[model samples]
Target: MSLSTKSPKTSPIKIMQNRIYELLKQGKRIDGRAPHEVRPVSISTSVIEKADGSAMVSMGGTKILTGIKVETGTPYSDRPNEGVFTVNAELLPLASASFEPGPPDERAVELARIVDRCIRESRAIDLEKLVITEGEKVYMLYIDIYVLDYDGNYFDPAVLSAVAALATCKIPRYEMRNGKLERVEGESMKTPIRTIPVSVMIGVIQDRLLVDPSPMEERALDTSVILGYDSDSNIVSIQKNTPGLLSLNMMEQIIELGSKKAEELRSILVEAVGLGS
Candidate 1:
């Protein structure tokens, strides 16, 4: 007599995961984008008149607004000759159902830190040029980011908005008179920009990688990574989310893909801000 064997039944979740993987294998995503394709990006500068500089970035369904305020303050004790720079992010409750109205949770904090790292590590801003009186006084830049909509990949748009805002920032000139500093009316100078930093988010599912994953894609992803690169194609920052492990070969592939994407994003930023390449 021969024993009959039956295959184990596949769980619904597993079936769904398999479907996603299959689609990716065919070079297609649920949203009809290719594995390496990103969503359409739109950028608008000078959105907020009151702020020194401002920009709004929309990537697919995700929207982010960044505003910059410049003020004069004493330089840090250790870095007396350099100016101050701070980045803050807020995920409004209206942006997503998961967001709550209160102080920034871990997600918001992480978002701010990621953007800060990209700018700081890349040295995008010429901080020394912001110094007003060397160690005595210096320009303090406050970059505030707000999530107007949350679809999935907000990291790229947040960085784009912040960088665009900074690129268009106009700081009022100050002159020292009678042992006090006074702003020169009708006189302002553009923020000194050294380089532009662009960030790209990639999601890994099974053996395929997706660029600018949507909310559904994010939920199905095994892991995700964000890579920031300067205009010179040098990596400035890296952030990995989720617990999935990536092989050395996969990591190298990600870097190569990210560098090319970063260049494309940088060109968009430059054109949006009316800057020369």
Candidate 2:
């Protein structure tokens, strides 16, 4: 036998994936989880030694690492007194076979945009507070997300990871005296923030819609919808990229589901961040 030949006792992961897909067609899952039930999620914070703030979120077998870095800079001309926030996502090759090593691909860019928009456009951060000087000094927040593992439904996990990191993030203490800037080390405090936004995705396959779909379920779906909700369960943003039509009734149903689930997920984030409310 050739050295490259496989042994008789070989395991086939693809076969199992196909089997799971077939079972899903029969309205069942191999793990007995309901179609809408999300996998178990575990979250940890302050993992990166260098970043100002960091977090690691694991949803089932998927793992994502997020870091937040805050720097002082001049505010954008359009928003003189307001600070700026930017999000970047990197899906390393180690995370999954589909991802490659390079700059952010379209999927990663879309993911970052969705997460950034939900927070930035929702007026969650107190950008005015970030202004150390009127149109002179402002804070710039850079959020980086690295996917360490791949299971399924990476979008939700990535958002949660970003938020967790942000909640624990600390802004460097700076003071301007006589037009001179000074940085205070180990004396920084939490960044001023406002509302909390949560993102939830639903998959539409044929006539049925499912929440928290696995990788296989995602591949089988006609399209997917990502709904972002605020702490008050108000819809903030909606992004749909698939060529599928959604009825008003279906949209209503998804909104209700997404709102309810967002509240549930917010509780998890609150506990992770040790918030009073």
Candidate 3:
């Protein structure tokens, strides 16, 4: 008697995902990088000529552009002494097949809010210096982030671009003319910055961690965490995306790795801002 056996067929998506996860378990990756290594990142300032300040950061296949447009605006009643800072993130359809044409969904909103808080809470820029007429009007810093690709890990690069853009940005110098703000011709000044906050994201699947996972790896991961570190080596912001329960040990491990990455990224930001690497 003869017996016939057949192997079950697997979908390409499932096979691809399995291949990625299998490599993770073996301390290997599709790109042949170290388990905790990040993709090569390059940054340049002033990509958008019309924007007062702009920067583009490319990490592997992922790319994000941040543009800053500072203008005179009214201060909020609750914080009349502070200038308004806003971050808007756009996941354009052209960037990826998943991003649709419509209002920003929860993902977009969350991305913007996280980056906004990082800059605001970290005191990256001295908002008080933006005041022109005190409670009447102040220079509002509007940061718009454009996602040009969706390989993975957009948050860290977006925040980096925003900071770089702001650091190199030029705001029009205005003086009170007839008790009204008047722009001074042929004069512009750099944004008053206090510190640069570096944000880093890590992908975790079980006890395994990847510093900057590719899109496929990110999709297969169970959890991810974002950490924002200030110049003082203090944690400024933390955002977690967990699909399953993460233990305290896992959180600490993530923190320890993230802190080191933050310091490295901050030096890159400082150099990009013309301070030094």
Best by lDDT: 1
> Could you tell me which 10 consecutive residues in candidate 1 have the lowest summed lDDT?
1-10
Per-residue C-alpha lDDT of model 2 across residues 1-277, encoded as one tens digit per residue: 1111122332334655476556667777766786667788888999987898899999887899999998888888888988888999987888877677988899889888888888876777888888888788888999999888877677888888988888889878888988888896668878776878878888775556677766655555567899888777778888885556666667777888888878878888888888655
The segments of candidate 1 whose C-alpha lies over 4 angstroms from its true place after superposition are: 1-15
Better of 1 and 3 by TM-score: 1
Across residues 18-90, which tens digit of lDDT does each residue of candidate 1 receive?
7778999999987788899889999999999999999999999899999999999999999999989999999
Per-candidate TM-score against the hidden true structure = 0.94, 0.89, 0.91
For each candidate in the order shown, give its overall lDDT on alpha carbons.
0.88, 0.79, 0.82
Model 3 clashing-pair count: 0
Cα lDDT for residue 191, candidate 1: 85
Alpha carbon lDDT of residue 15, candidate 2?
A: 59
Stretches > 4 Å off in candidate 3: 1-18
Ranking by lDDT: 1, 3, 2
Please give, for residues 156-221, the per-residue lDDT of candidate 3 as tens digits: 888889989999999988878898789899899888888788889988777788888776676667
Better of 1 and 2 by lDDT: 1
